[model samples]
Target: MQLIESISKRHSPRSFDNKGIEQEKIELLIEAASWAPSAFNNQPWRFYVAEKNKNPEFYNNALNCLVDFNKSWAQTAPVLIITVVKTTYDHNNEANKFALHDLGLAIGNMMNQATVLNLFMHQMAGIKFDKFNKLLNLPQNMEPVSIIALGYLGKIEDLPAEIQKVENEKKRVRKPIEDILNYSPLK
Candidate 1:
């Protein structure tokens, strides 16, 4: 699919099918994330993938970390992907300002790739940080940034009323290019 078309079609789908996603496909999605650009090539992102059926307890625990509204639909996604950023780059390196930005790029790549694969993805920030960190056994330096729920698409009817309302009115909304870009005259 073209980039523009994919961008338009891609959305945060809250409802997902129960059918399992192929392991290979999941790997491909991760591969897509791996190629995303990083600051000084630090490659600080790490993904923790949990297949729902295979690890129900872990999945439930992760889901429980989410806000009640997000939990309502997130539980149905076949896979839960926890995105983390490694705070340290090297033994002496203390600054990692771009870690989250790099992770965001990787996630954008993953979401776009999912759209091309006819899959659905939703990045969620509504989570209990402390609980998620402990449940996933993440080190102190590895901060969890977001949770991505992945699976095949499901009917909008499956979503809660509040979510369904948002989904129904969804359309690509963005700021004008001129508004986003500034071309200052030389001083």
Candidate 2:
């Protein structure tokens, strides 16, 4: 049994090359994300991009919003994006429970596009929420989700010695499908 090459090759690495991503590729990632299905077709996902080469100051500001641990390694990535979501439906002022899920779908699409472009992405939940919210001056109805670092693979040596092997050389593993799928009664 075979899987999509991009899906199988996709991986999250802490080490990223300093080379900048081309503008066209970045637009393609966003285009893919924009097409993800959303509840009521609201398309709540919003991206705050910081390209190291194009917007260094904003890139540094975005980097500062991440926790120290993430900041340490994420700095090497050429592109950083903070995904934001609208918490309420645009047609009505009611809450949208599926906002986050929709955001995840959008990010998934973006990551798949990245893989096709030979780029890798590492999505981190280690953000300073308060700082990030304030940094972007986000509205009450919008929420910051996760920070994503995107770039080409870098030397394992660029990562801290403690995690070098773990990040770049470790074997990939996943739980068996039987462990996750409910083939029979839950009991």
Candidate 3:
């Protein structure tokens, strides 16, 4: 798919079908993430993935990390992924101020790649930090970022009433460039 088309198609779908994604497709998404640029060439992003059928324990663990609202709908997805980043540069052991930004870029790349692969991803920031760290036994230096639920889109009618309204009204909306862009100081 063209870049613009992929961007236009991308959406945070809350419901998913039961079908499993091919391992090769998942690998391509990760590969896209790996190609994202990082500050000082410190590729700090890390991804932990779990499939419901392949590993129930792991999938359930990932599901438990989400906030209650997300848990309700995101549970239907076939794959769950947790993204983290090393907090500091390895060689110097100094704080990497751009680590989170780099991780965000990686996720953006993955999202577009998923669109290109005819898949969908819904990313959430409402994660239980302590629970996630404990469940995964993450290193002290690694910081959890977000959880992503992936699969093919399911019926929007299955979503909660409020969410269904939003999806039905206008699935996508964004601030116009004129409204968001500014070069001069405000009066």
Candidate 4:
């Protein structure tokens, strides 16, 4: 698929079919993420994935990290992923200012890959990161960035009433380039 096509198709879905995705597809998503460019080649992105159908324990562990509102919808997903970024460079233990940015790039790549495969990924920052850190036993250099709910598209009506209206009515909007672009730096 083309870049624009993938970008246009990509959406953070709130509804998901509770079916197991093939392992190959999961590997493809990770492989796509691995291709993202990073500063000094210090790729700091890490993904912790749990397939609900295959491993209920792992999936429940991930679900416990989400806020209640998110858990209500996210529990239906086949996969939940915890994304993390290494905040420091391994060499000299220097701060990596672009760590999060690099992680975002990796996620962007994965989103496009998912779109190409007719899958959906919904990412949220409403996670209790400390819970994830405690449960996953994260090293000092790593930190939870976001939680992603992933699966195939499901009936919008499957969502809770409050969210169903949003699914039915919401439209994707983008700010015009003119509104964001500035030729000169403003003081």
Q: Model 2, 1-187: lDDT tens per residue?
A: 9999889999898889999999999999999999999999999999999999999999999999899888888998999998999999999979999999999999999989999999999999999888888877888999989899999999889888766756756777899998998968987
Error of 4 at 129 (Å): 3.0
Model 4 earns a TM-score of 0.93
lDDT of 4: 0.90
lDDT of 4 by residue, 1-187 (tens): 5559889888988899988899999999999999999998899999998888788898999999898889988987999988998999977689999999999999999999999999999999998777877867888888888999999998888889887887788888889989999999989
Model 1 Cα shift for residue 177 (angstroms): 2.5
Better of 1 and 2 by TM-score: 2
Error of 2 at 18 (Å): 0.7
Question: TM-score, each model?
Answer: 0.89, 0.94, 0.91, 0.93
User: Residues 69-148, candidate 1, lDDT per residue (tens digit)?
Assistant: 88888887999998899887754578798889999998888888899999989889998877877877777778888888
Clashing pairs in 3: none
Q: Which candidate would rank higher by TM-score, 1 or 4? A: 4
Q: Sort all candidates by lDDT, best to worst.
A: 2, 4, 3, 1
List runs of model 4 lying over 4 Å from the truth.
1-3
lDDT at 4 for candidate 2?
Answer: 94
lDDT of 1: 0.86
lDDT of 3 at 73: 83
- Candidate 2 residue pairs in clash (backbone atoms < 3 Å): none
